[model samples]
Target: MACRQPPLNSKRPRTLLCHDMKGGYLEDRFIQGTNTEDCYIFYHWASIDIFNYFSHHMVTIPPVCWTNAAHKHGVAVLGTFITEWESGKDICESFLSSEDSFRAVADKMVQIAEFYRFDGWLINIENLLCPDAVKNTPIFLRYLTDKMHSSVPGSLVIWYDSVLEDGKLKWQNELNNQNRVFFNACDGMFTNYNWKEEHLQRMVAIAEDRLVDVYVGVDVFARSEVVGGKFETNLSLQMIRKYGFSAALFAPGWVFECLPTNEFHQNQNKFWNLLCDYLPTHSVSMLPFTTSFCQGFGKRLFFRGKEVHAGNWFNLNAQEMQPLFVDQKLAGAGGSWVRTRGCSEDAWNGGCCLLIEGALVSEKPNVSVRLLSLLAQASPRLFISFIYKQDCSDRVRLALEVTTTNSCSCENSQITTPQDHRKGTIPHLLPETDNLVSQFKKQCDTQPVEGWTINCYLLELQESFLENVFVNISRLPDADAKYKEKEEPFAFRVGEIRILDVNSLFAAPVQVQNLTMCNTLWRRGFNDCKKRENQLYLSTTLRWFYPPNTAVNFRIFCKGMEHHQSVTIAESEKMVLIGRAYNRVYRVVDIPIPDPPVGTSGQVEFLVQPITKEGFVGQSSNCSRLVVNYLEKQ
Candidate 1:
């Protein structure tokens, strides 16, 4: 069950995001559950390297949705293995009874991580252990670490700084001899949040070469003597960086939990933006890269430039590789504002798209945003494609920012007016003083959805490798003095971005094998569900498999038809996207089968469509389907 995928091993100071919610498991726990209600989602994957799903449960496995999203950005996902309170103390006694029991427990933990396909575990032992159990605690930690490393290479087992060597449950707040034994046993240690400046200095002294391995914990909720958290969480992050240590941000979802739902997205971005200078950005190395700029959760669902489902939904599995946007602050200069965020109002590919809306000022007429940190070797036949649209008439020139090995200077480069490049133009290269290069392309295809236009340009790269790519938007410099007087408003949206080697495009993965449905349950009617009065609620598990990473994910849809008395009309035959599956297994809970007349039968055909990393859909012939028959019982 070990995930053969390589684990995260960042040389820079790492950032571990520990998600601690009020109630651990929610709609996300069902894996493919269709959630209409409001849910919390983390989209700043580039800001952090490790994500730990934590709860009070003894085995808090990260839901597959989180794992899928995290893994897409090369971020490692970890589940919490915690013991707390009175009952936890008893659980520890049983596990730490003897050497064999401890090893067995460690093996089980490793198996869980392997089966779940997550990176590793966050060992948070918050309960007291007896004298004998304490003696065996380090033994358990060592065995778990060894097994995890061997079974899942590059996997991690981070210990929490809680228990003292004397068996007492004491929060040392930093690395010391009191809890150094456990730190030595594990890959890294997440220190408690109450640590002071002196504690951090001492921690650095003790950590020595392994300073990055010791995660200085910061409670975003501002518990204990933690310097600053919540809106000011960056204060603590800056301090942590000054001392040269990794950070463990506990409950970074404070924006979702504390702020209003309407403000969640803005506040979340603001919170992370504060730490931009402190945390290192993760680079994209994998090929066939694509992103719709989807935040994964949205008010409506759109697929392939069309609206598919019109209901509020949250699914981290569907989240694309988010663009690393740095907020541009004008500092109260006229009506000028330059910002970028995910918009649910419209999308060309998925549920959301990247929206850049703002007015231009004399000081900052053009906004150049860094889209991605890429480490890629460009081939001769490489293609870069993206869809964009301008909402306003203020003509703006668009350019792509790229970094090459050759030094090219943009010091004397002037901003140009928007041009009609319907037949493609040679990219404008900088002179020989800078590494940054700006390239522009011609419009290729116009999407049916709104005014979105697609641009696919073949890169005739003179250099071999690229370090980054950015999105640049600029306006023409007018000679009239009134040009600066009028703050030009521009609203542009990028629907999707795709980078691939044209000649070596990967073949679509084979169809899912062993397609089957089991544990089917049908419900007739419930009084509380007046909205779905005649809907037959069918709960089932649709299991299918393609290899791991065969395709990014499988989009589950149903072509259902309910039979009537006189004629078998195609009532429910409209293709409906029921849910999405990151893994092979998807639970079909409450797939509303329209109520048929008594004694009449109905059939539902579930389709599994694989979507690749480069936004390529598998052939219809290669799709797997499951047929389910339901009869109305008197």
Candidate 2:
């Protein structure tokens, strides 16, 4: 997915994130489901939102995953260009041999920046250079900086505090004359993390006009130098701010990579909060939407904002509103299992859904999601959409069980209300019971072979509903005698579980129409649909009733046959721009259509979700399907 360059922020004390995890990107999974805005609340005041993908390579482009995740949080991401160790010295020698050679390399680097859509690069030259090479290095840096600025506006080229003007690999750890020459050529410099208080003061003095450009480095994992790394991290942050310098935090992945698995989220919070204590509190806006589930699009397992490369996990539930719940104890303990196979396309806006199937035990397993108070106060309507499929010809029943406590007001106790509420026991409160507010059932069809149908249940909440409510999708007891003895469990898959505020006047509805599909191939740099069986693409036209400058997004969901069962192939696109356009716009999306499962007719289903620019997902359009029986002969 190509993206436009992020806007520049002139905020002071900018925080640069140097992401280095296990030799850089090895077994690295960027699953940012948690609200990072809340995690780094201190960063709101200080511009703490630049992510740099750090690796010891000649040309390291930031991965699409990192770019997508960072952009979602309104953060800028940068790739790395480093020349380190013996091989790097050779690379620098060949590139800086002549002025023309240097200029040619700089142009190529500029081309890479335009192609990848990252903001800029962090140039780290950590190897010794010859006198001739060192003299031309500044020229090369100047050329690269000028070309990059011209090609990609608002782009940055940060220099690491390594290598001196005398052609030697030295860590100055301060903004002195030895490194001042190189620093002057780039946008900023990242100082070595092993600097002292005097060094920071000296650097601040040296960078009098551009204090924000000099970023003091802090290594959160290196305990040998920084005693009590977590607390010391706060001290470094304080000292950098006191000296009027930006901060560069290196290797923050230590919170996940080194800490205990269960305590990863807690330790991460504590570590960040220590930094927060030094800085003034700032209120970051809560995310407009949040959801919790154990399953994802690919085979990789992501739970509680952490990704495990290898696992066919089932029944692992993460915590609500917090990012620390990787419960391995319940792995495969199984009352509810996620069925990646035969899963229908997600009916809602997200990439994947909870494909659950199992018999209800004496204590029914339930997953509770915490909703924001904004949602409750808005008195929004909740919609639970899922696909139900079963072997028996019996009706499948499920319900939304809401657990809320009611607060009663006294007749003439306005003065006593505060004390009663604080005691957690209102004298006039009524006893509350769990209410089965909404129920949904799918009746047996005429042909009872295994099949699925989409169902939706809506429940509108009032202000009386408590802050935290648990909506459980549980199986109701069967009354039929004949089917009661059957051991086979009924299966149902949840697609879109959303809470929407329909009361807002600005919340206009969007409609998707005129869906079409065709087979296409990339020939001569353009899509040609003349040839069949090359690739499948779908196009749809959308209409919305919103004013100009309103941002709208369309997400396409596709389901195809895999191993004789329907499984989701394409969930959603990464950050497609449908915003700022007038009333109607047509979008063409690639549909991932695999060969039909054995003994099954080739078919695919497409669904579209229209969402607001603020991340509020709307209802799913009715499925627009295509049958590919023509490919069977081929």
Highest lDDT against the true fold, candidate? 1
For candidate 1, list the clashing residue pairs, or say none.
408-434, 409-431, 409-433, 409-434
| TM-score of every prediction relative to native | 0.85, 0.55
lDDT of 1: 0.74
List model 2 lDDT by residue over 103-122, tens digit each.
Answer: 99888888987887777888
Report the C-alpha displacement of residue 622, candidate 1, in angstroms.
Answer: 3.6
Highest TM-score against the true fold, candidate: 1
User: Model 2: number of clashes?
Assistant: 0
Model 1 lDDT at residue 303? 73
